[model samples]
Target: MKNTPSTQGRAYSRRDFLKLSGLTALSIGGMTVLTACGPSTETKDSGATDAKSDTASSFGEGGKLRVGMEVAYPPYNWQTSEATDDTIPVEGLDGAYADGIDIFVAKKVAAAFGLEAVAVKLAWSGLIEALNAGQIDCIIAGMTPTDERKQSIDFSDPYFIGHYGLLVKKDSPYASATSFADFAGASVLGQKDTLLDTVIDEIDGVNHMTPVDSVPAQLSHVNQGACDAITYNVENRGGLLAANPDLVAIQFDGSYQLFPDEVSCNVGLKKGQDDVLKKVNDAIAAMGADDSTWETIIARQPA
Candidate 1:
C-alpha cells in the first residue's frame, strides 16, 4: 500500500459532533473512574497547570529541548531498540530509541528553537501529567486538541492531520459494516484520554467498553472477541493491519463526516509559552508545505 498524506483539511469542529455538553457530563460522571485509572497525578505545582494561562519563559533553559511522547503509536511514534540515522535515543531509557513522524516533528521544532531534540518516553495516560509535573518540556504525541484538553494545556497548530477509521475482525459481523449506525450494541474499545473513546457514544447504542491503556490492549480485546471493533486513524492503518492480518480497517462511506478536531494532531504545551508555540507552529507549517520530505518520512515507516 502506498502511504500518502490526506488532502482533506480539518473542516469540522470537534465540538460539533461530540458536543461539549456531553463531554462535560462524561467527565463529571466519570471523574472517579478517570482519577483511579487515567494519567498519573504527580504534578509540579497544583496551581500552575492551567491551559489558558501562558508562562513567559522559553522551553528548556538553554539548547536542550525535551519532547515527550508515548513512543508506542506506530508510524507516528514508536520504539526502536537499535540506533539509526532517523532514531533519537529515548532520554532516560537505556538501549531504546524513539522514531517516527512525531520524532521528525520534534527534530524540526527543536531546530526552529535552536535546541537539541531529546525524546522522553512516557505512558499515554501520563503524558499530560508529566508535562504538568515539568518532567518533559512538550508533548509531541499524536494528540488531538479537543476543547476539554484546551482548558489545561495550549496546543500548537496541527502538525499532522489524521483520518478516522475502525478496525474489526475479518470474521466479525461488523467487518461488512458501512456506517456508524451499523454497529449498534456491538462492543467497541478505545484508548483512554483520547477522542477515540469519546466518539464511541456517537454510535448511539454501541456497548462502549471501558477504555484501555494502550493500542495493544485495544487490539487484544478485539482480536480475542472481547470487543467487536476499535477506533483508530489513517496513519495507523499500515502498522495495525500488518500486525494482525485477521483484522481489517473499515473505511466508512463519504456520507459520514468526522469531527475535524479529532483528526488534527498538534504539539501540546503548558498554557502561555507564546514564543515557543509560534515557533512550533511555524515549523509545522514549513514541514506541511514540503510534501516531498513528508512523503519520504511516511514511506520509510516500519510496516
Candidate 2:
C-alpha cells in the first residue's frame, strides 16, 4: 500500500464487513454494544491497571504503534492466513494478518511517530478498555466518534467519511426502492450497537429487526429471508455487490438520502494522549482526498 498525501479532497463514506469460519463475539452493555466494529473471538481485557491517569500519555515498548481493531471487519479491517505487503501481523493470532483501510491509516500514523505499525486483534467492545489499560496504544478500527464514545476517549479527525444505505437480495422487493418512503412495511436489519442499527428508525412503517452482532451476520439473516435488507456503507457497494451478486444497495444521493448524510470513521485514543492525538491527526490531515483511493482499496478486498 502507498501513502496518499492529504489534499483538500473529501474522504469516502463509512465501512464494515466479513464472516469468519470460526467466528467469536462478546456481549457488552449500553452504547458499547452499538459501536461500529463488531465482537471478536479473542478477549483483549487482561485486567491490567489503568495505563492512563493524570492526563499523561505513553507509547508501547520497542517503538511499536500498537493499534487495536476487531480484525474481522472487511473493507475496514479483516484477518487473513496469508501475508501480503499490504498486511500487518495480528499480535496474538499466529500466521494471521490484518488488511484493510484501517491498517493503511495505522501505518501512516505510526510512521508519523517514527514507529512500526502492529495490529492488535481485539473485540469491538474491548478496544477502548484495552487502550485505557495499556493493552494497546490506540484503536484504528472503523469506529464513528459518537457523542456517547467521546465520554470515554478522544478521537482524531476523521480518516474516512461515508454515507449509509441498505443492502437487499437482488430479487427482494426492496431492491427496487429508490426512496426511503418505498420501504414501508419492509423488514430491515443492521449490526448490533451501531449507527447501522439505530438508523432503522428513519424509515417509516419499516419492520426493524433485532440487531445482529456483525455485517456478515446481517447478511446471513437477509439471505435467509429473516429480514428484507441490511444497513451498510454505500462506499462498500462495489466490493459487496461484486462478491454477493445476489445483492443490490439502495444508495440515495438525491431527494431520499441516508439519515446521516455522512458517517465519519475516526481514530480512538485514550483521553490525555493530546500529543499522540495531534501527531495522529497530522498524519490524517496528510492523507488528503481519499475519495478515489478508498474505492481502489475496496476494489481489492478479498472475495
Candidate 3:
C-alpha cells in the first residue's frame, strides 16, 4: 500500500525497448555508461548451470546488489523520470529511475543483505544471461520458474499470481469472447519470448501472429489493428485499460486456464548460488502471503 514514482503519461512507442550491445558493468562505481539488450523472440539456451562463480554469502561488489529487469514493463517494473523516496535510480541512466513491485521487492532484498540496491535495465532474454555472466546479481523482473529455466538457473518463490487474459480492441467483434474456443480463426499476438506468446497456441485453429519484441509493441499491434488480440497478465487489467481505453479484456470462463498457476512469478538467479538463492527466497517469504501489498503496487502502476 505504498506509492512509488510513476510515468507522467501513458503514451508509448517502440523506442521504449532499446537494444544495445554496449557493456553494462554490475560493479558499483565501475560503469560510466551502460547499454542493454532489446526485446527479441528468440529464446537462447541460458547455460546457467555451467556459469558458476566463487560462492559468497554476499553478492555484487562495492556493497552493491545489481538487480536486473525489463524496466519497460509496468506493474512489474517501469522507467520514470520522477524520483521519489521509493524509487531506485536506473544505473547509467542520468535522470531516469525504476519503480514497481519488482523494485519494491528488490529493495527489500538488498536491505536484508546490507547492500545498496541498483536497478539494471535489461532485455527479457538478457536477464538470465546477465545473472549467469555476473553482469547482474539477481533478476527481479516478474520471471517465472519454469523447469527449463530451472535447469539453467534458480528462482525464488512466487510473488504475484495473476490470470492470463487476452486484450482486444473495445469495438472488435471478438471483444465479447467468453472462452478460448470463441476465437478459432482470430489472429492473436504476444510478446516475443514470453509465456504469453507460448499460450496463444492453445486456441485451436487460431492464427498466431509472429510475436513482437515488447509489451509496448504488443499494445501497438492490438491498438492499431495490426492484430486482433494480444495476451497479457490479468493483474495489469486496471492499468492497461486506463492507458488504452479502446482495448477490452476477454476473461475466458473456467473451461481452461490460459496461464499455469505454478509459474505465476519469481525472482530468477544464477545456478550454484545456493546461499544467494536461499537469501532471496527468504526475502520473498518475508513479504508474506497477503496479496494486498502486491495488488496495490499493480493498481498504482503508470497508465
Q: How well does each candidate superpose onto the true structure, as a TM-score?
A: 0.76, 0.79, 0.77
Question: Which consecutive 10 residues in model 3 have the weakest lDDT in total?
Answer: 17-26
User: Model 2, stretches more than 4 Å misplaced?
Assistant: 1-58, 251-257, 288-292
In terms of lDDT, the poorest run of 10 residues in model 2 is 18-27
Candidate 3 per-residue lDDT, tens place, 1-303, comes to 111112222111112111000011111111100112222212233432234555232466878888888777766787767787667878767777787878888888898888878887777877887777777888888776666677888876665554466889989989888877789889999887777787787678889999987877888888899999998866565566666779877754532224433235677887887888778767776765344455455545553
User: Can you tell me which runs of candidate 1 are displaced by over 4 Å?
Assistant: 1-58, 254-262, 288-292
Residues 205-231, candidate 2: write the lDDT tens digits: 989998987777787788788999888
Best by TM-score: 2
- How much lDDT does each candidate structure score? 0.66, 0.69, 0.66
Deviation of model 1 at 109, angstroms? 0.6
Cα lDDT, model 3, residue 150: 78
| Model 1 per-residue lDDT at 33 | 10
Better of 1 and 2 by TM-score: 2
